[model samples]
Target chain A: MTADRPRTSLLGTTALLFEAPGETTLETQRRIWAVAHEAAGFPGVREAVPGMNNLMLVFVEPPRRPEEIEQRLLELWNVVAPLPIAGRCIDLPVAYGGEAGPHMADVIEHTGMSVDEIVERHSAPTYIVFALGSHPGYCYLGGMDARIATPRRKVPVLKIPRGAVSIGGSQTGVSASDGPSGWNTIGSTQIAFFDVNRSPPALLQPGDSIRFKVARVLR
Target chain B: MIKILSVGALATVQDLGRTGGLSLGVGTSGAMDPLALAAGNILLRNQENTAAVEVPVFPFKVRFERSTVFAVTGADCAGRLDEAPVLPWWAHRAEAGQVLSLSHPKQTTWRATRAYLCIADGVDVPAVLGSRSTQLRGSFGGYEGRPLRDGDELPTGRSNGRAVPGFGLVPPGLALPLEADGVPAVRVLPAAEYDCFTNSSQDALWSTGWKITAQSDRYGYRLSGRELNPLRPLELRSHGIVPGVIQVPHGGQPIIQMRDAQPSGGYPKIGTVIEADLWRLGQAPIGSNVRFIRCSWDEALGASADIRRWLANSRRLVELHCGERGGR
Candidate 1:
């Protein structure tokens, strides 16, 4: 028998993916996470992780087959989606060039904009946090202009300093911890993006939006 | 107590791993070869989830501070007491002030097998995210928040008061039950990007035996195979990742994720390895030719359940080896 449900993908044999129906990315993600979260709260749901565009769903109880979950998720997606939920917008202050952004030279060369001009251009737009979690509080923003998209470092560094703002292709992120990264450093922030003791350990989450303010505040 | 005569590369003590901390981007660092550790613990009659030593390049040495009972499980290597040969995959005992030496093998079989030195008690490291795993990236858990090193004196817990004499050791190039092969057949279930690959690449993923690259480890296995051209390299929403997820990057290189992987990722995953064969794959060594075959969830569950059952039956009553688990 054929299935009637929102677009679904199987993750392993025990998990189901629910993609929301929408022309735009955000609309689809909103639907996806809503249903995924609801399913996560269900009795047998093991884990529910929401992404910028999709949600990963897993089952807890054995014999909780993917097909059965798929059918149930389809019905759940139909009901739980279309709910009212607005993503948050987080503002960040950054100091591009000099030390904060070691990759500023590369960004300048790619954009053909002087250091000062590049900082002004980058801080002008409010970008959406398309996703997060490559690093703690590291948000992946996707509204970057094609002209400014720079290729990642050919040789990745083993430890990128915390709070270092970096870019790879069209996306920019604020690194919360020292890590091995291929992203080009564009700036730095003083924000402590993640603290396990904090209520919400991560400062940025998928579906959130952020606008950078070019300023120096590293303490 | 044990004195690490030599520190192996990127070694640590780990169990199954931790969860619920992906929100902070903390990776789950557990044993690379979970089966080996499981089997090792089982051989010693310890809890399957007990933390064990995870060494990379060379074997580690330990000088017991007190008389203790323990086990050595996983890959066959040159192990001994004061240079006397010893056998792997078995339990052993030591006296106070005794120096136990182990030398690294050529890795003719598994890429890595962490030794679970299950004492008369068990390792006493603090638990983080519901496990005693060592997250090197987050720098939490395991021995002193890292791997064991030279001159480290770890405490032992209440002993079971039993002793297992050390097993006999074999020299290098000796015959063993497991041998390193180039690539193994790993079973998988398709993922969200299963359709992204071209039909040929999809078939090749199963049909053509992919060779394991040199850069294989607990985090992931990098494989060299025919690039599976997906329908699109569409940016994906971040999703929780499990061990064995096959993630294909820009060049068509498929990296099979392992136990220490981050909790989530954005790369388009084609499928995940079946749980039953995870241990076999763990032993396959670099340059092994590997293929993937799809299996139902039933098969995966049955195999993992069997492993757990085997562990429960085989584990011994070991005393505590590390300190007590503290609040994170």
Candidate 2:
């Protein structure tokens, strides 16, 4: 798919940012991945981190000639194609509402849907992983049905448990560890999002897809 | 090995941090003053990335379990070995059962809050995700995944007996200075959302004096300065962020993310402190004022090169001094 002109900016001396097209879109993210893949090959490149629609290039050794890197990135974006959605599919079993879902009532009140309807709507769509941020192994996902969309909590909770599935400002994510969050939680999964013992500790990666299954429900 | 007799506030094991893990939502949690960490390691002839005990709050006391060479870097904390005075930034040898103590720092040439206790061959800790630095939020890595406390025992990496005592190198802060128009300042490069801020906000960011607030820690520094208002209300998505990014939230005060900051944030980033200048920010004491100097990409890279040059020179000097002693 054709994308808008990729916007390039310097994060600092050691890091570079390339923003693709507009807002959160799969096409733009795919373009970002394409650029990220290409930028990773550049000299002095240390890490190529992808976001919702942006790619961050971190260099251990700052290139003496930065324009060369920028030019190369621009050139790559010109010939960019959608990166293949190639990753493992993971099934996340969620227990919706009650103690497991601390903020499920808030979500139901905001969406004005029956608890069962909300669960059906949430579990139906197979969300696409946009990026990982906020915490270790926390996946920022897209493709949530608009019917269940809810704004974030005004005052964030101090400590949300790990594996808590949440929604915040049109996006859905799972807590990687026990930490504070602003997202309204509706359910939680028992699976670990991060394990220090594992290689690439995060369970999900960009381009991976996740399907939520209702394991149980609590009133 | 060493046993903690008394842990003064916050003390954790840190190296250069886990760098390649940000993509997986893991933050780079390392030494706040990496220059000190590097210099301490160099004094002991240890690897640059070797883990060291980062002691922020002082009045700390530890007892060596065996004979070992060590160095204390960063703040001049008036350290002592069983009541005998030990110089800051100098390498020293201690015997088994000898206790080392550090008191409140006496700021002389540099205003630094943290001090690093570096032992030869680095601290003996299992590297988590390729680093020994403590990730406090996740509660893993370093010594038992937490700060050192009384009775905590820390092992030492095996040294090659090449480290020498009674020698020292100048602190990197004194060796490489960063200033702007006579004011100690850190260079900053504008970030992606720089233009979203108001003209006054930008001007104040560059021109005003920002006092590091008490709320500051390894996670970030909350600076009390001229209010930085954005041009409009921006609803930003959570995005990738690195340490040194200066972000402004609804309160108008700007916060500079530090080594332990989260990997991503939704705040509007006005500027990013140059990577080379981060050490200066790390040493800036709470309640102390600091200024921001706008610099170009090339200048920022040049600063990094300067740090490399400094490190290389220090390494060579230490090697020469230790080599002459013939592996004492």
Candidate 3:
């Protein structure tokens, strides 16, 4: 066996749980993913899942004694350094306010601005994907215009329309599918965030960058 | 094959869990009480992760369309057939047309209770991923994407061996029951930034007890406790997370992730409930008091291993107490 492949035992299996580090969202996910990917390159590890701040490395048909595996994990985590995130950018088009987005007033009030001001401020800045959760292609993003930073709704909307563009505090996200939400809705985007038939399903991922083009009013 | 004479308040097929659909946002629907599921399987000498029936409350009943072997485990609720009291963990064989019924549990509230029935001949729900477990959110698995209702006909997998007897739950199952005493306290490992919280904040975390709100569901538990403020102006870039993640927002009350939890999160998490103690979360019904105690990473890892082993070996002994079913 390769020197990198240290064997240990536990739960009739061996696993390496890596404690990777990074304060920023993209950086942290990138580091965790790199270590997990690298672990898979080695033999014996059955599974390697990279999480927000950690990696769960598992063995294939592992030994029963866990202490053996625990010893190996400690050693592996010390050596594997995490990597930074690198990827391409994606832009989306969105329409602000009206029947499509009923909570536009709430977002405007929270931002202490007029509706036009809300649209301009929001569309002016770019956002980064922080994580993907709740729904497929549903991105919890960072880099919202801080001028519009506000707490979640006092009463969460029971059914946020699909494709609703909303902001929570300083973070922003696009709803892929209709669901409940506490995020203040400022607009709606026609962009499809998720499609079951797509090869990768979600249009965006944790490392991707995004920009928005505000929709103009129709005469 | 066994038949459904009655299916309590909530009953359906369950296995270890349903994965692969997480990225798609499907909840890994399975037996709330795994220990109970294992006992139901072991008593019938079935695989630990075999598909079994999970009965959440009263008004559920089943009848053996044909003679078969099966067992019931989890909760102290009495299983009856024509007023005959049956055991909980032991396997019991049934004659043709013999009806098996699970009565409502006497001990707890809205979410408390378990009644798993394992058949010697496995259930025949189509394998939707690698598991027979249900993804109730997507209406993907188990009986028509929901619990068993009246007039539902179940097919059976071919028996590994010809005509073996079955069993019912052992009396007084080991796990998943409330109104019991001195439950082993749940242990947690501080999150990546555990020390990020002020000493007062962290101390409050360990000392303060939060109530499990009724608003809780498969997605997450919205805990109610003291309002909290961060020591620093915090703005964390969103990141990935898992079940049992203790996410503390600007509001002091923390939201603990659960089975149907999303794969990632942006909220600042103070800690994670050790894998072993996650089951305790299921047992913690609404309005129950909960507290957290932090442990070292090493300790958390060690506990995970011990839990897996305990679950594996315990299935055998728990099955022993159940009544065996005799095949016709």
Candidate 4:
């Protein structure tokens, strides 16, 4: 059964989440970005943020008529065509395995692949930035090689350091800052994905492409 | 100016918090008890979003470098200014060279864990991305983007000279109290994945009194109660979430996201503590039990309106009190 209807849910009284139904795809996320851009102009809307395939519209004030806003969002989503954002493609040097990747063995164990095989597969795709979330400057990238995909850890790590590259289920992303995470870390990077001093702060935005370069393989 | 004589951990400069940064993955890091911050600002006749010192850990002591008006609101820490008792939720004038000390929060009349120290104007911190709130994760706002330390001297903004001391307003927590069977309660609305949870788990969520575990902090509150099991193994794509989003991890326990919670999460959401009631949860002491009152979208909005009405009414009353004293 195809869950085709775009689902709208209240996030407390502050914001509303609009989730595009069906499989998570580039097409759906593009439309989400478009809707976000449009809904941001709505009265009382503070910020329109796009997630993987969802959009959350935070209000300046708790919306008096939420149903009206929801209806407007649905109308916008139906009509607003997919917007292709022109974003920069940045190549990041990644140090895979060894101490940098304490959970590489776990990923190998789960995926039934060697460390070399996993690294090759992980770095093969030119991933697109699906959305930015989780933490400051962190980007949720799409197009990870499904063969190396491993489920998130049953128990999340209390504190993963900044620049930790990890895989969670079918998705892969890097830790922009030191924080708790539930993903399986397979590598580490030295790039600062976020700098508050820097304009726009986050290194990547939705539609940006990332190519991981294997700097070294510490077996 | 005030010199931090002695300060406990996690006390930081905060305003209302930075917005429009969620798309960049920046979470809103502000006072845990925002009502206290706003009320303190109201007491001082300062801007509603004026930066204040959020003192969670106590026995905080500061020496006033200049005579300035200040107010201590939220959890009454038994404030004392140079041997003179300074009432909580009241604005007072501090003489130059006077030391203001705050002790452990008294849980006698009101149960709260955080306090806001609002100066006459505000804490003079360089605003980053439209706010002075210390974003601990990003480390780029407030005073040096870190918690206050001993010997740290925070500059206060130039006083508008309109502040009149000796006036106080009723604390919003006392005015707008929400409880379930005498236990401090927060209203919650069902989230996107509410139906995904088992019927028993959904029932348990409303009926059970969840204890705030020690792991609870500004980032999120780890609640311990009846395990919130889902109907099936549920996995969600990472989605944007605000403070109060209740995510049920695979472990079955629910975690209520707080002010410093990340912009997104993938855990199955059972319900969200309404934004209006987040301040109540924010002030809830660790190890304390809290009940969840299931509410509708309309009810949640109503609660938010109620808080706004309370703030406006309090502000009006404070203005009148200050105006009368100034006129005299």
Best by DockQ: 4
User: Which of the predicted structures, 3 or 4, would earn the higher DockQ when compared with the native?
Assistant: 4
Model 2: docking quality category? acceptable
Q: For candidate 1, write residues B156-237 as lDDT tens digits.
A: 5565544344432221112222222334466688886787789998888777877888877776788887876777555443
* Stretches of model 2 off by over 4 angstroms after superposition: A1-4, A91-124, A146-159, A180-189, A213-219, B179-183, B323-328
DockQ of 4: 0.72
Q: What value does DockQ give for candidate 1?
A: 0.37
By the DockQ metric, which is better: model 1 or model 4?
4
Query: Which window of 10 residues has the lowest lDDT sum in candidate 4 chain B?
Result: B319-328
DockQ pick, better of 2 and 3 = 2
How do all the candidates rank in terms of TM-score, highest first? 4, 2, 1, 3
- Per residue, candidate 2 scores C-alpha lDDT tens digits across A175-215 of 87887666888999978878877776778899898999999
Task: Give the winner by lDDT.
Answer: 4
Interface RMSD (C-alpha) of each candidate? 4.5, 3.1, 7.6, 1.7
lDDT of 1 by residue, A94-158 (tens): 88777778888888787887777667667777777655556445665656655666766544455
Give per-residue CA lDDT, model 3, range A1-219, as digits (tens).
012332221211123334444333455555555655566655556555443354554545333444554565556555756665655687788877786567777776666787787778888866766445566567766566668876766444557877788886667778877765667777787777766456576677656778888875211
Between candidates 1 and 3, name the one with more favorable DockQ. 1
